[model samples]
Target: MSTQINTIPASEAVRSAEERIASYDWQEFATELSGYGCAVLPKILTPEECKEIAALYPHEEHFRSHIHMARHGFGKGEYRYFKYPLPDLIGGLRTALYPHLADVANEWNARMGIDQRYPAEHKDFLKQCHDAGQTRPTPLLLQYVPGDFNCLHQDLYGDLAFPLQIAFLLSEPGEDFTGGEFVLTEQRPRMQSRAEVVPLRQGDAVAFAVHNRPVQGTKGNYRVNLRHGVSRVRSGQRHTVGIIFHDAK
Candidate 1:
């Protein structure tokens, strides 16, 4: 009698991830982003994977620097920027998500009267950032305890901003945290700032404007300034992984 083994090929795993990203209704996502300046994506990571990524937080070697938000007036929580040679899952996600986001970035840039256009691949964009003296990686993992929060701010690293960024909730909303809602504020010209509360779940991700986006106006297209933050966490702890395409200065 012969024994049998069952296993998935590495190529199959990559193909599945690629297909999952490609199969998303990006048209709908684009519309949502164009209308609201942010879009929430379906579950891209499994619950187990979310837990696994969150577990990496305690390991200091993986991170180059750990930031205390309160010390920097950023908020009450803390976050760590990953060092070079990111984890395989993170690097893969960064690469796989870039092309689709680059399309949207280019469209927004054109509409906003900006001349900069992103490259088709993430590595090419990183190279451009490096050539401009931005060598630090910007991808980070953020942790928040009860009463911890983040300030409404932009993730502008240098002159070559990608204009788009994504954050994934690694913990369950109500179970892991209560009042830590994702908040975004838009400053339209000649008007009061408007706040938007985005709802998310574990393994869910949101793509949002890093600084600003273009909105159609009577004359043509106008730029609206935007910022994002986390509301105070009422109870429990929260963890999120931020995927930023640009390198930092």
Candidate 2:
């Protein structure tokens, strides 16, 4: 069902966010996660910006139209993840949606631990990733986990990829729900299953490369990737935004 979208003055949110992000130095994060890969950008979006995004949910709903494969690992009735696209508004979309994410991506790129894997791999093309046959060039997806969850697996979308991903937690998380801990894989090769569970609060975000770390080859040394999944929210609903960037792909 289509719902109404209420657009607020989110440009101000972006502007304020830009200032904070500029003054904020992630040098510690850079030092700590050199090889591991992690950065926590707090309050990137004001409460208002987040609320506005949530408001556009049903109005911008696309998954309702198509069922992309999700991890219903528990069973049939069990929904693992509800991933959908986000709309791009001008004063709304560009300033409101992209800046903070772009900031994270750029910051992570400079770090040694979290390699800007894709761009390094695709130097042959004019851009980091090539958009060959795909219809929509840069696709953004949001996951609605109203008890749904994502089982651990590397997001391998052919070669058109974003090396790392960031989650924009739009809800109160635990307060709004429970059991949605995001587990991350620490070691690889010998043992591919050990993962550390990290619980993120509302407005908080987590970032990491698809594979665990940077590979030496132009292709992939594959960081074993995180074998992640949600613990199961027995109570409330969960809404998360995941934005992936590929060179034009």
Candidate 3:
């Protein structure tokens, strides 16, 4: 007997992604980002959609490069960066999510006293990255089995860095994985580092700062540095898809 796999058409996938993205209360998302440096966009993808994306992990044709975290001292497990002409669902999410993120990113840059601003569209921003010779795609699929974890680190790839990115949990927390939690750390000037463990369910996406974000201080807005990673997986398997707006050099 043979099992059949279901897939969404490119047009339908893009439409679904756009419609779901449009339904969110972005003002609340922006507020959350301003206060915490991260915000959850719950159930942005359906469980079946999550499974479809995760199922692409072992296919070599879909990716540009593969990375083993341990070889780079980036902790354990492995990941693969997608090539240009990204899979429709991933590409759709990337295109649909950027404008909203750009608004928040531009505001953060202003508050942090950084002069950089992102373009209003994802394609225009990619053009900037490409013109600067950072042409490699940044979106990736990560897989971790038991005993794997990631180190806290920023996702900056080139001289031009987008302030925010998103990661979707493609596996169910309790059933498909265990003990591997999404973690973010913030370091404020002249103070201790603060850690936050974000709880996520299957198909949920978390948007977060890629490097620096502004925090309101008694005097004025001050910049805080942030790094994100994952805790060790105690049992089962886990998968995630990351959407980074800027390309790599």
TM-score of each: 0.94, 0.64, 0.96
Model 1, residue pairs in steric clash: none
Better of 2 and 3 by TM-score: 3
| Best-matching candidate per TM-score | 3
- Model 2, 141-237: lDDT tens per residue? 3444445566566665555555555666667765777766666665565655565666677777666556545324445444444444455556676
Winner by lDDT: 3
Over the full model, what C-alpha lDDT does candidate 2 score relative to the true structure?
Answer: 0.48
- Span of 10 residues, lowest total lDDT, candidate 3: 1-10
Tens digit of per-residue lDDT, candidate 3, span 23-85? 999999999988999999999989987888888888888899999999999999999999977
TM-score for model 1? 0.94
Q: Give RMSD to native, each candidate.
A: 4.6, 6.3, 1.9
Which candidate model has the greater TM-score, 1 or 2?
1
Superposition-based RMSD of candidate 2 using all C-alpha atoms, in angstroms: 6.3
- Candidate 1 ranges with C-alpha deviation above 4 Å: 1-16
lDDT of each: 0.89, 0.48, 0.93
